[model samples]
Target: MTSTPLHKGIHPVLEQDHPYIFIDACMQAWPDADYAHAHRHGVTAYAVTAFHPWAGLDEALEGLMFWHLSARRHSHLGIAWIAEDIRHAKREGRAVFVLASQGGDFISNALHRIEAFYRLGLRMLIPAYSRTNAICGGCLDRADGGLTSFGELVVAECNRVGLLLDCSHVGKRSSLEIIERSAAPVVFSHSNPKRLVDNPRNIDDEQILACAARGGVIGLAPWGPLVMKPGSRTRPTLDDFVEHIDYVAQLTGSADHIGIGTDMSLGTYPDHEHDPWGEPAYAAVTREYDQHVTADVRSPLRAVEGFSSYPEVLNLVDRLQRRGYGEADVRKILGENMLRVFEQVWR
Candidate 1:
C-alpha cells in the first residue's frame, strides 16, 4: 500500500493531491539510497556540494544515482563541485544542475583555479564561510572585511565566466562589498533575514534590499536560528518559517526576490550531530574547543515537524498558495526565480 504524503492529514488538500517539488539547495553528503525515501513524498532531489569532498570526485559521483532516480518528478541541482555533477546530470536527462561553492576556500588564493573550476562548470562562489579564508571573512569572523584583492579577481573572473557570486556566508561588510563590486546578480543561497531573527548568519534589511535591487534572489533557509526562537531546543513551526518568507517579501518588495533553499540537510544529521556543535571532523578540531559555541544551534533538532523531509516543502508552499500567494509567485519561490538568476550569471 502507498503511504500518505507527509502533509496529508495536516492539510486536507494534500491528502488527495501532492504537488511536484523541485529542491534546489540540497547537500551531497547524505547517502544516495536515501533519495527514495524523499521520492515517496514526491520530492526530486537536486544535490549540491561545497567543493570539499571527503573522498574526492569519485565518491561524490556515487551520489548522482540518487539524484537521477528522482529526476522525473523532481530535479534541481547545484552549488560547488558543479563541473562534474552538472555535466553528468545534464547528460543523464536528470535535470539542470546549477554550480555553487560554499566558500572561497576552494580557490586557495588563486584566480586560475577559479577560472579552471568555472570552465568545469562552477556557476556560483561564496566568498566566505564560517571562518576567514583567503578571499574574505565569514559572518563569524571578528572583523567583517569584504572582497580582498584576490576576491576582486574572483568576482571579475566569475563575471568573465558568467558564474554568479554568492554572499550567504560572507560577513555583513563582505556581503555589501561583493554586492557593490559584482557585475552580475549575487545570491544568498541559504540565508534568512536578521530583521526577523537576530542571528549573525541572517541578513539584515539593508542586505536584503541590496540583493533584490541588483536583480539577485535571496534564498531563505529554513534552518531554526535563522527563522525562529524556541527556547533552547524546540524547532520552529511552519508558521515561523512563513513569517521569514513574509518578512523577506516585505524587505525585497516582492516574493520574486525570495525563494526557499530550506538548507534542510535532511536524512543527513540532526541538529546535535551537525558541525559547529559536533566534533570537528570536517574543519579544524579547535573550532569546537569551546562548548558554548554550539549552544543555541544544539539540542532537540529544531527542524519543523513534517518539514524535515524534502517533499514537505511543497506542502508548506501549497499552504502559502492557499493564503493568497499567486501561482506566478509560487513558481518563482519554488525554483523559477533562482533559475532566472542562474541564466543571467552562469555562462
Candidate 2:
C-alpha cells in the first residue's frame, strides 16, 4: 500500500506513528462484518450513520441498536463513549464506533429522543439529510428557510446532550445557523469544497470560514464527483484527494480545521473498484451534471482511476507527507481535530 502520488518518502517520524487516532469522521454505514478489516486498515474510530431519510422512531432505534449489539458480540468492535474512549479502544486493538445519524427525521419532532439516543451511546447527529425537515433546511430543497424555531431547540439539545452537530447535506442557510448557534465546534462530516467541484453538496468559502471561525473541523471527503476538479474528465486519484487538503489548508492558513470524512462504504463496488455514480445517493448530482454541464456526465463517472476502498486509506498519509504537510498538522487532519471537538462537546 505504498501507492502515494509522487516520490518523496514518508517523514521518518510519521513512520513510527503507532498510537495515533485515525478516524474517518463520516462513513455512511459500517456493517458488523467489516470490523476486522476496518481495524486491519488502521481505523481507530468512525462516525457510522444509522438511520435513513424518513426513518421514524422505530426504525431509528433499530438502526442504532444494531451497532450496540455489534459491539457486544464482536471483540474487534468497541463502543466509544467519550472522545477519550477512542484512545483506550485503539490501544486495546479494537476499531471504535461512534453511533451517528444522518437525518433528524428519526426523532419525529420529539426532542426527548435526543437524550434517549445519547443515553443509548449515539454521539453525533446531522439534523437533516437532503430534504427539508421540521428541524432545519436541506441542501436540495425548494427554498432555503434557514434553521427554524424547532431547529434552534435541536441545536440547544444537541449541545446539552453531548451530541456532535454535523452540517453535511444540510441547506446553506441552516448550516450557517447551526455553525453560529452551536456552543461547541461543529463538523461537515462528509462534504467537499464547492470551489473545486461546484456541487451544492460542497460548501463555499463563506461557510468554510464560518465553520472554522467557531473552531470546527471540516472533513474532506474522497467521494469522486464531490471533490474532482470542476470540468475534470477523470475520477479522483490520490493526488486529486490531497489537492483538496491543499486547497482548504491554503484557504484557511491552517490544517487544524480539516479531517477526513470518507463518506463511502468499503467493498461497495468490489467487482468494479472504481464504482459508477449509479447509487441512490448520487441521484441529484448526477442529474445536474448530465443536464447542466458539458455532457461529461456519463464519461464513466468514476469508472476511471480513483480512491476506491477503505483499506487503501493509509496511502493518504503517504500522499500528505509527499505534499509537504508537517507531522502535527497531518495528525490533526487525520483524527486529532475530530477528537478535540468530541472532547469539548461531549465532556
Candidate 3:
C-alpha cells in the first residue's frame, strides 16, 4: 500500500477513512492472540522487547527465536526490519512486529552480538535496564556511573548497524552520554516525564530536550505512577495520558518529539507459569525494588481506563482531537514521529 503524503495542520479523517499508524514503541512481548487483537484495532506495528535483565544471552536468544517462530506461524503478523515495513503492514492490513533488546546484556560480553542481533531483525537496543550492568549504569543504580568503554562500543556498533538506541531504563549520566555519543537519533521508547511524575523511570526535562535536540522522540508510557501523581485513588484517565504527551510537546515546543509506547504485557503478574519468557524471573528483582516505590499502590498497566486492550487506541485518537491537536500533530504523536526516527537511524 502506498502512503499519503503527510500534511501539516490538516484535520485527519476518521480512522476508517485515513488508516492511522499506531506503533507501540516498547512492549514486553506480543503473543499470537495479542497480534490478532492488534490487527483488529488497526495497530500498524509494535516494537517488542526480547531481552530482560533476569535472562542471560541464551535466554534472550531463545526469546527472540520464539517470537520469530510465532510471527512465522501467524499469517497476519510480519517482522519489521525498516520503516517501509510499517507502511507495508498498514497496506497489507497486518501487524508489523519489531524486536528490541530492553537490556544490553543480551550482547553477553560480546560487542559483535549487536550486529548479529541486527541481522536477526532486532532493531533497537537499551544500554541498561533498572540495574547497572557491565555496559552502562541504570536509573536505579546506586551510583550514576555513565556508559562504560564497552557501553561506548555498543553504542558505536548499534549506530553503525542502524539499530535504534533506547534510553528508557538507562541512568541519567548514561542517557546523556548515549544522546551525545550516537550519531543517529535515539529514543526513550517507553518512558514518562519525571517532572509530571517523580519516578526514576521517567525522563526529566533536561533529558527530554537533549533527545529532542538530536531529533529523537520520547514515547510516553501508559503506566501508572509515570502518568499520574503518587497516592491518587483515581484511575489514570485518557486525559492523564494526554497530559504527559502535552507536557512533552510544550517542553519541546513541538508535538513532533512525542509518541506512545504502552509497555503493557499480555498477562498480569504472578500468572507467569505459561509465559513465553520462562517463570518471570524479573518479578523477584521487582519485588525487591518495588518496596521503595509506589507502583503497588496503583497499577501501572491500567493507568488509562480501557487502555489495557488494544482497541482503545481509537479512543486516544479521539482524545487528541478533542484536545485541539491537529490531525497532523496527532498522527505524528501516534506513530509518524517514531517512524521518522526509525527512518533516520535505520539508514
Q: Which stretches of candidate 1 lie above 4 Å from their native place?
A: 1-21, 35-47, 53-97, 230-233, 270-300
lDDT of 2 at 24: 84
lDDT of 3 by residue, 1-347 (tens): 22221211111222452468898898655342344444555567878877565577788888888777877878888888889999888888788777888887767688888888888888988888878888888887677799998888888998999999999989999999999999998999999988877776888999999999999999998765566566555556778888898898899998989988987654333233356666422313233224433344224334466454455677788988998999899899989999999999885
Candidate 1, residues 1-347, lDDT tens digits: the string is 14432321111112322433354553433442243233243333343653442223333233333333344344443232333443344344333434456766656655776677666655666767666677777777677677688877877888887877878878888888888888988888888877666776778888999889999988877665565552334456677788788888876677889766765543333233346655432322112212322343222233454454455666677777877888788877876677667667766
Candidate 2's TM-score: 0.85
Candidate 1: worst-modelled 10 consecutive residues by lDDT:
7-16
Q: In candidate 3, how many Å is residue 184 off? A: 0.5
Lowest-sum lDDT 10-residue window in model 3: 2-11
Residue 156, candidate 2: C-alpha displacement in angstroms: 0.7
In lDDT terms, which candidate is top? 3
Q: Could you tell me every candidate's TM-score relative to the true structure? A: 0.74, 0.85, 0.85
> For residues 180-202, what per-residue lDDT tens digits would candidate 2 score against the true structure?
89998899998888887788788
What TM-score does prediction 3 earn? 0.85
